[model samples]
Target: MKRTTFLLVFGVILSFSQAQLDTGGEETGGEEEHVELFTTPATKMGAATSDFGYNLFRALASQEAATNVFLAPISVSAALTQLSMGGSEQAQRQLFRALRYHTLQDPQLHNTLKDLLASVRTPGKGLSTAARIYLSRRLRPKQDFFGLVEQQYGVRPKALSGGPKDVTEINNWVSQETGGKVQRLLTKPLPRNSGVNTVSAAYFKGKWVTRFGQSGAMENFQVDGGVPVRIPMMQQDNYPVKMGADSDLSCTIVQIQMQDDVSMFVFLPDEVTSNMTLLEESLTAEFVQDLSMTLLPAQVFLSLPALRLSYSTDLLPLLSDLGLSDWLADTDLDKISTQSAKLASLNHKVAMETVPEGNQYPSAASSAHLSYRVDRPFLYLIRDESSGALLFIGRVVNPKDLMI
Candidate 1:
């Protein structure tokens, strides 16, 4: 939706710890299949085409099914945007299949997907004949999302909402459920006296198995919007870089490949005076599919800031700018929200802050979470390791407010 609302929702739903396998793999001491949960959530939330999107979808689907999460809480919005941009209903189904595939992430998680799908895609919701059958056929009956939620997060919704609840109770429950990392969500001032209108909060934390160095921190890296700011620029020289171009945009991505041909392609906006959207919009499925055939490596510097930031913005305007007028329109986006839905306007505030747990460099032997800072705006995606299908996509303009 709007930038602020997106951040606020992100802060609310994703306030969990560094994502880990949800009890379904030997790697993490579970019986379920072991799949690496990357920093990127799998689906490139708003992107229609990108190498990361294509490759991620194929790789994860082929190897192990995946489930993608979009913090925007506006799947319909995202779906509508894609549809308006020529993404068909079939494309939306494929998106759901890939996203619902997260069952492979963990058995419990998978079961959750199964139950949710079954519950929501019932027979009488005006679904087309084909759509009803497709929904029924695609989902499993034994899967229960509540089970997965309990197994993964150690709490149940029933316990959280034991009695009749008000807005304040819901916010408190979320805060307590997420270990106090989230607060003031749908509530007024948190901490009883902070007096800050705690609209919403989301948190995500991840670490590189192989951390980077902190000694070479630099400053004055010009971020988006031509603004020079002080940041700890983590630099890696001689790293492999893949560059490609399409009718839409030219791009450079770092390919982090894993077992069975799965890869995570990171695309950064090429430095320019205008903005990063030029580079991002130009990236598309055809372009990435073309590049996948001929990925060449070039030595380059990967500089990232080591900083924690919090930001606030009004996103109604931004969402409108991004072609999501349907949601902001007075019609109330009737496609998704029914007359019974109780939620008010979706406003969001997100913050991301990370500290180096150990030394910042590999040679020096440290554990540092690679936190990205986009004073302007940046996009990221997770691609299938093998087929180059996109699993998840997201963007951040003001990284400071991200509760990582």
Candidate 2:
């Protein structure tokens, strides 16, 4: 049998919740400690848990603290969890804590992920989650890791000589998985003599329940503390959406539904300037959960940026700051074939678009339409509708910000 070691190092960027427990959580918890990731009958509690994980990551990865930062917390979590299959004990602990699940101590976490992936991937879902491992020609991981990686995670390892060909192959895989939304993941040359590589990706093409007009008009938007510029604002009048104001952060919160039980939450601060700091500080899991509970459904006019955006990030330093420095520096890969190697790179890329509504909608009269228009800098989250699990979190200050 060939010994195989995993190179669970992934670099991805581009992409971008809730449900009923229908999972029977209480029965399992009483007899076993396997805190079913699906811990409730209604996807709400589990969704709440997943949303918290995303927030924890957002807190750590916000490099431009006050600028336009976008990410799929779900993508980040999935990528790290995929890496955990090959991590040492200490590394697993650190990764768990960073993901806000350190104390749960669930033995079935990975298995739960397997089940969740299966349920979410179906016909016409409009969302895709994928994982791939590319092993260096010279390195062979232990047999068990290879088997588990494929059997449980649904990822098949592709062996390639690490060079220009492998780079193109890896990027091509990402492009195919994301339906060509993401073009290239590895723009820079790969580190020579590397033994492993990993890639985790998510892609979602959200179709609006109530479509916006195809041709949007240019409107003035406030970005970066009082600077005004014209950006195309996708418009839909009398859009039925949930709305609320969060006093804790003085931000207005809006939630709009997409197909397949997914929703988008927008956080617009009352005061345009100096509020992002407060808004970021207050965006905790508890805050999100409370907002989900309190938001009331209403009719309003909605205007959001009609631009496609993509981001690429070098995540090693950020991961280090989130308490994984030791794992990166003194990694123990005894679980895999004892091929000594450190995490070469962790990059992420995501592409997201707010497309216009499909059919012409008759204008419905509603007073809320006069007041609710997102014409300035704000934060947005796309998530599961019932569970409120975050799939993507991003800030929009410039419509052309990192257009991919």
Candidate 3:
């Protein structure tokens, strides 16, 4: 398989609602308790959504090998799932299949998602997610569907004013929800004939648990095609990280801790020119969870680039490629409105930035001999340690290509 210079970044947040699911009883203790925590509906839903996130990333990456790709899988899945509530049984089935949630028949999926979203939006986590549904003024949503969406998804369907003001209002909502990290999500107004449109946005700006030292002079970052560009590189000596090598994927994996129980995992190929097709295919929720548990901890001299990447794009084509073309074109959402309504558009925007900031001071020289330098294209993901949810997944083919 041909390799592509790719970076996958995923983030997970702790679940605040897990405790509510626990029966009020004496301690089951030890391994059993651990199993219980992982088996919660919310956690399972998180895994399912994470799998969807990986698949979505694959679809986007295949379209353009050189361009960077970023997305908040949870946000997209949340929006689609919420919309599914207003869809016919067949429509629900189709959407579920696309989301890799066909096998999950639990009725608590929405409830679980609500809890998950709450946990994801917990203050001080440096991460936020928002999803909303916009309807054409001519379509009046059924009372039941409107109430369900608001109750479960925490968002009420808003009627589009069918003017430029609609665009501004939607953009303003997204900006406010994401702490202003994402602005003008919709540069132009939606099509006048658009029936139902969904928007999702996620923002993250996390501080490392151990901050990197001051950035050194500009360094040469090797791009995919042997091209190099000067960029600021953050350096830290004796940085505590979980580092390992995956022989199957032919890449070096490193896990750096961030605040709020979030960890950023970076997958660096053995060579800058190495292909990442295999690694990309190997990514799944189960694989990531297993890998996270198996890595060994060590202190290494770490060199990483300061990254600020913002990506916004219409996901209709990508979702269509993921077996949702029919759903996008036409679907039975009769529950939402007496008149026929189909998904008109699906838009997603995400922003992520990593600076040299950290919770602790840098350590002095250590007894470690290994060095991990991310000077080339790689894959990274941010994962929440508590819920095991993937908050963000992205690839950086070239830092310069994504700087904004």
Predicted model with the maximum lDDT: 3
Off by over 4 Å in 1: 1-168, 176-180, 187-202, 223-227, 240-248, 256-265, 278-294, 297-299, 307-343, 347-377, 382-404
Model 2, position 266, has a per-residue lDDT of: 87
Query: Ten consecutive residues with minimal summed lDDT in candidate 3?
Result: 8-17
lDDT by residue (1-404, candidate 2, tens digit) is: 11111121111100001121123233322323323334443343345346554554455436666566666656566666766777788877767776666644556777765665655554344566556666667666777877877777776666677678877988888888788877787786567666555665666667777787634688888776556878788876677766666555677778877777777888887766523765665555445655554455555667777757877665556766556677777756555556875666666777777778643363566434234678777878776755446667777776645576
Error of 2 at 139 (Å): 3.4
TM-score of each: 0.43, 0.81, 0.88
| lDDT, residue 327, model 3 | 77
Question: How does residue 381 of candidate 1 score in lDDT?
Answer: 47
Give candidate 2's error at residue 323 in angstroms: 2.2
Error of 1 at 306 (Å): 2.6
Q: Which scores better on TM-score, 1 or 3?
A: 3
Candidate ranking under lDDT, highest first, comes to 3, 2, 1
**Runs with alpha carbons beyond 4 Å of true place in candidate 2:** 1-38, 41-61, 103-105, 123-125, 136-138, 225-227, 358-363, 366-369
Expressed as tens digits, the lDDT of each residue in 157-272 for candidate 1 is: 22121222434665565455334654554533222211111122343333333243443365664444546645555454333334332223433444543223334455555443
Q: Estimate the overall C-alpha local distance difference test score of candidate 3.
A: 0.80
The reply for model 3, stretches above 4 Å from the true place, is: 1-38, 365-367
Winner by TM-score: 3
